[model samples]
Target: MFAARRFSLYERAFGPVVTPITSIRGLLQDFTTTAAYDAAQRSRSNDDYFATIHHISNIVRRDIYMERTLNKMCISKIVNSELVYRVLRSCSRSGIESFRFFNWARTHHPHYDPTTLEFEELLKTLARTGHWETMWKVAHQMKVQNLPISSSIVSFIIEHYGKKDLVDQAVELFNRLKSFNCPQTTEVYNSLLFALCEVKNFQGAYALIRRMLRKGAVPDKKTYSILVNGWCSAGKMREAQEFLEEMSRKGFNPPVRGRDLLIDGLLNAGYLESAKGLVRKMTKEGFVPDVSTFNSLAEAICKSGEIDFCIDLFRDVCKLGLCPDVDTYKIIITAASKVGRIDDAFQILHRSIEEGLRPFPSLYAPILKALCRKGMFDDAFSFFSDMKLKGHPPNRPAYTMLIRMCTRGGRFVEAANYLVEMTELNLLPLSRNFDLVCDGLKNCGKHDLAKRIEQLEISLRGD
Candidate 1:
């Protein structure tokens, strides 16, 4: 009797178990057909999600009674928090409309509760549209909800105000942070400092830094960089140096070395010689500069038409225990290629690989370009093939570049082959490239090949 009762209970809970498909064909179809159906369903669901948002945006934009119309459509039942946020983003430029949609979601949608994501997104949207009064109202609402605004938002607003030359407003915002229940952090201070620097209010900017220290908020790398950069931009290197020294005396070394900060400042200020001299002194004394700091200097020097000098500097820094990054190799390789030093470019490329860096098109394309420039077509082809063989295949831009180089050299057959190969790899060959190859082939009396190229374009485009 207990066994019968147990079986009855199981049947009530799970119902009778459907018999599993026993045939091989049925089992295969269960996996293969069901999986494909599921994938298709997901694709359709994604399409519907975007379509729904677009439809809502259109209504919000055109209909005066958009909220009522959405309600009558039973949007409250279907709408979710994520859907509401997406719709807000879609109509973001329409600040009033975006706010209405957000408000509608909160009040009307059955289960749609606004989160911090929606709140911050609305704040940012309102701020972007210069809806200052409305933005404050939203902030007040956030405080009511116990959600204090983020420091990032403060920084963005300050930067915006600085861009519009509203320095006073930026300051007002900084001073008003306490009322918003936001703590005055380094980022908040940096924004104000940046605003001061924008207006060349160096005196005020410097004072702000001292104020930061007094408030027990330590200035970070960005703080030092900003002040130093501002001073450097104004050609007041002496004052910048004095400020650094004074800060050092106060037991506040920057997160990065002060010297690196100075170099970066000098570089931004267009005082390349001062930066170069400072770097030389550091490296000469066996002090390794930050790779990024050195890279900035190296990049700047290369642009000044002294790539060879930059290369020497790269080697000197490497010897002093400074490992180079991908960007470092990219800079030297590009410079070498531009000056027709293919051999040196090749050596740099290999060196970067040996240092455990993968090759990118920008890194190797220059060498191919240099080879092509010097009529070393075979070498360029060999290099490209070798790259593919070693698992670092060129991307679309690189393929387009190679095809263009081939066409330029009257190698239409090779160009046509590459065009096919690119398509085989699922890269869309531009229609213009197809026309160029077809025309070239026709002009060379290779009509058969030209027809094939034309047919391939038509097929790929599904026209």
Candidate 2:
């Protein structure tokens, strides 16, 4: 009894009991001839058969008697067969976590199978989903069990985890790959560098770039663009510019659009002179300035109250045989008007029209307002009439400006007539315009006319 119990304990602790070959053959023949086994074999391919066998092994392993019997049978039949490797690969892809069993089988029973492709696919899938810990376990299994893992596979894992911001895991895997004598490729360095830069870890990014250079991995234009953008974003315009210069010296042209972005960053940070200088340098480099670049420069100048400089820049653009678009004219007009240069503002309007540029209402509205504000009502009215005759009728805002100017200049009859015209044009008179008309009539001592204006305002409000 004592010997039997000891044997049972050994079997339970280790594996299943090995039946004799005669008994195993009998069992195999019995199952093979059975309708159930025939149907299963006919319906499932060899891949699915192995999958089913592994699943059954798992289930039997949970039972003490069945586990001992199955383990003994597997050992007897040679655990690390080609069929077993396919089964293991399938389990790994299916997330069965039975790879450890395959590791044990391969360790204790030597066998080789050329299924590295499937294993690599599994590793890539796992890595893509940020399963780094599983990836580490699989890598260790592959190394210890003598399974093949390629450099491309290792690099793929590293790149994937790097993109996920799992830098420690990526580095750990990278070190393991180095132990495998895999050289760091340019793709690997680029992935890590970009990842570091994405997190704004410029120190890490810079170090990685230097390390890659030491590894004889030449930095490309993309690498420089990333660093330059990072520096510019961090308000290190000097550093960004220096890097750009370095890139140029190295026979690389960093993207011209990057210069525009750098200029915008500088301008937004109140480094107007640096922004302007950078734009000038970019222009001198024969990089054509995009509309947005010009707009940013113009806006920065206007914000700094450098209206004269903005006008000069627009003039310079014109002198370059580049006809200023309506938007350009609008910017110039706004900048001039903001500085009380009404004459210059109108000069831009006339020039735009003469250049065959269609005048948009937005362009004319502000100019008319500037004229009215400067007490140039006759000039404003004349421009409005000219615009109307030219088939670009004054809009609501323009008519509002005219009505306001008329009332403010004590022209009550003109104000009233303009109000009627605005209504005819379906442009509702604002409350301020009504107030203006009332005040104009009262100021002229026309009390009855003032009352009439107030009554009309009430009627309009009711409608």
Q: Pick the candidate with the highest lDDT.
A: 1
lDDT of 2 at 161: 67
RMSD of each: 13.3, 28.1
lDDT string, candidate 1, 1-463, tens digits: 4223323432332333223333445656765777778887899999987997899989887789988888877666568868878877877788888888878877875577688888888887887777778888888898899987889988878877776678999999999988887788999999889889988999999889988999999899999999999999999988989999999998998888889988999999999999999989998999978989988998999999988888888888888999989888989899989989888899889999998899988899999988888888878888988898988988888888888888888878777877877876889988889988899889899897788777667656756
**lDDT of candidates 1 onward, in order:** 0.84, 0.67
Q: Could you give me the TM-score of model 1 versus the true structure?
A: 0.82
- For model 2, the superposed segments whose C-alpha errors exceed 4 Å read 1-200, 203-229, 233-235, 242-258, 280-288, 321-323
- What is candidate 2's lDDT per residue for 148-200, written digit by digit as tens? 67767776776666677777766666656567656777666766665666567
lDDT for predicted candidate 1 compared with the true structure: 0.84
- Between which residue pairs do clashes occur in model 1? none
lDDT of model 2 at position 69 = 51
